[model samples]
Target: MVNCMKEQVFFGEGMAMVKRDYPDLYEAIVALNEAAYTGKVLDYRTQKLIAMGINAAASDERATKKQMISAIKEFGVTKDEIVDVLRVVLLTSGMPPFTKGMKILGEVMEK
Candidate 1:
C-alpha cells in the first residue's frame, strides 16, 4: 500500500516551522489521521470517501487536493469517486465552488 504520510506535501515549507514551534499539535494531527483512517468505525477506504466528500465541499482547494491525493494513494480511491463527490458538492454548494474544486482535483490526479 502507498504510504500516505510519506507523500504528505501540504504545508511544504510551513511544516518545518510548525514542527519547530508546535510539535504537539503536529503529532496530534498525525495520530488523528492514522487512527481515523485505520479504525473499525470506518476503514481507510470509507474514511477516504468521507474525507473526499468533505474536502470537495470545502472552500480551500489546496487542502482539498492534498487530502484527495492522500485518499487516492493511501486508500486506493479512484478519480471517479473524487469526481462523484464533487458532483454532489455541486448540487449542495452550487456549481462555482465545485467547478474550482474539480479543476484542482483534476490537476492533482493528473500529477
Candidate 2:
C-alpha cells in the first residue's frame, strides 16, 4: 500500500471555488479563516485539535483526516492526544462517528 496524502488540503472546496470564480467571496472567507485561527485565548494548536474533534463529531472524514495530518506535521500533535479528542466524540457523537474518526486518525498516523 502507498500513502498519497498531500501536505496541504485547501480549507474548503466551496471557498476555493468561490475564490476562483469570485475573488470577493474568497477574500471574506480568507479573512474568516485568518480570524478564526488567531488563537486569542486557546492558542492555534489547541484550536486545531478542537477543530479535529468537531470534524469527527460531525463525521466529516476528509476534514478530520486533514486536521489530523496537519496537526501532526505542523504541531507535532500526538496519537494519544488525538485519542483523547476522539474519546469526547465517542461520548457526544456516538460510536459510528467516533470509530470513523479513529479510522481516519489511524490512516493519517500510519502515513
The candidate scoring highest on lDDT is 2
Query: Which residue segments of model 1 deviate by more than 4 Å?
Result: 1-15
Kindly give the stretch of ten consecutive residues in candidate 2 with the minimal lDDT sum.
1-10
- Runs of candidate 2 exceeding 4 Å displacement: 1-9
Error (Å) of candidate 2 at residue 2 is 29
TM-score of 1: 0.69
**Steric clash pairs (candidate 1):** none
Candidate whose TM-score is highest: 2
lDDT of 1 by residue, 4-78 (tens): 343343334466675679999767666655665565776556766666566567666666777787777777778
| Model 1 poorest 10 in a row by lDDT | 1-10
Q: Rate the local accuracy (lDDT) of all candidates.
A: 0.68, 0.77
